[model samples]
Target: AQTVTQSQPEMSVQEAETVTLSCTYDTSENNYYLFWYKQPPSRQMILVIRQEAYKQQNATENRFSVNFQKAAKSFSLKISDSQLGDTAMYFCAFRRGGGSNYKLTFGKGTLLTVNP
Candidate 1:
């Protein structure tokens, strides 16, 4: 079983500023994937970034990056130069690497408000 947790239910950041959203997970599986998904007001799940459990390096995509600490079971997202378009519900997710079950367990989500 795997569970993701976002301690901050809501967070606000100023435009062009940087913000880090915290996420933690508990999983028994050794091989897995961790991801940060953004769902805007339009309700589309966009893959922000992903980190494989076996990879030592963190995953980054453009202005979005993740700090993956496997030992601590922590995977936090850092948004550099936050924009108004970045305002959305951010969800932390987990998926086991193998097996037929492709289920993605997601967190409740954190509402990020990018203020001008």
Candidate 2:
């Protein structure tokens, strides 16, 4: 079974700054996908970034980027030039890529508070 661990339950960042959210997972599966999803006040899960285990290059999308350490099973998300709109509950998720049910396992989440 794969489990996602979010060490920081809550985090805050000043507007227009950078913040990195930490995440670690335990899994024996060789091929898989890691993702960072954001849930705002609307409670809608939005994909921020994704990383394929087979890809060495980290995934990045605009202001969002990931630091994926495959050997250590650590995946962290960095938000650059954060904005008030970025305040949300961020979740880390995993899904097996091959011969799997394709069920997404999610972490508890980290609540992000972007200060004005």
Candidate 3:
């Protein structure tokens, strides 16, 4: 039971341009792990990129990137050049593939407002 779906509750970008935030997930196990968390405004919880479900090459960080679509389980997050500290509240996470209280199963957020 791994579910993550961020249908953009709020999003804005202008400082530089480029923004794509949309995700969908519902797993029934096949090795799982996908995350993209960034909560600013003093809520601190940052780790904006991670994907490994047998890895099909889709997980980058320098401006953040991911578009892992393992058979329609979509996972998307692409923010490039957009600065302004990347105003945050972007969470689309999931965890399951092992053990050890791998908690994390979120996605009801997408409040990224970066405008300068």
Where in model 1 is the C-alpha error above 4 Å?
A: none
lDDT for each of the candidates? 0.96, 0.96, 0.90
Residue lDDT tens for model 1, 1-116? 78899999999999999999999999889999999999999988999998999999999999999999999999999999999999999999999999999799999999999999
Model 1: lowest-lDDT 10 consecutive positions = 27-36
Model 3 lDDT tens row, 1-116: 77788988998989989999998999888888898999999998989889998999999999889999999999999999999999989998889878678888998989989999
Error of 3 at 44 (Å): 8.9
Which portions of model 2 show Cα errors greater than 4 Å? none
Alpha-carbon runs more than 4 Å astray in model 3? 1-14, 17-32, 42-50, 59-64, 67-78, 81-85, 89-94, 104-115
Q: Give residue 49's lDDT in candidate 3 (0 to 100).
A: 89
Give TM-scores for every candidate, taking all chains together and pairing residue i with residue i: 0.98, 0.98, 0.34
Give the candidates in order of TM-score, highest first. Answer: 1, 2, 3
What value does the lDDT take at residue 90 in candidate 2?
98
**Total backbone collisions for each predicted model:** 0, 0, 0
What is the per-residue lDDT of model 2 for residues 34-93, given as tens digits with 9 covering 90 to 100?
999999999899999999999999999999999999999999999999999999999999
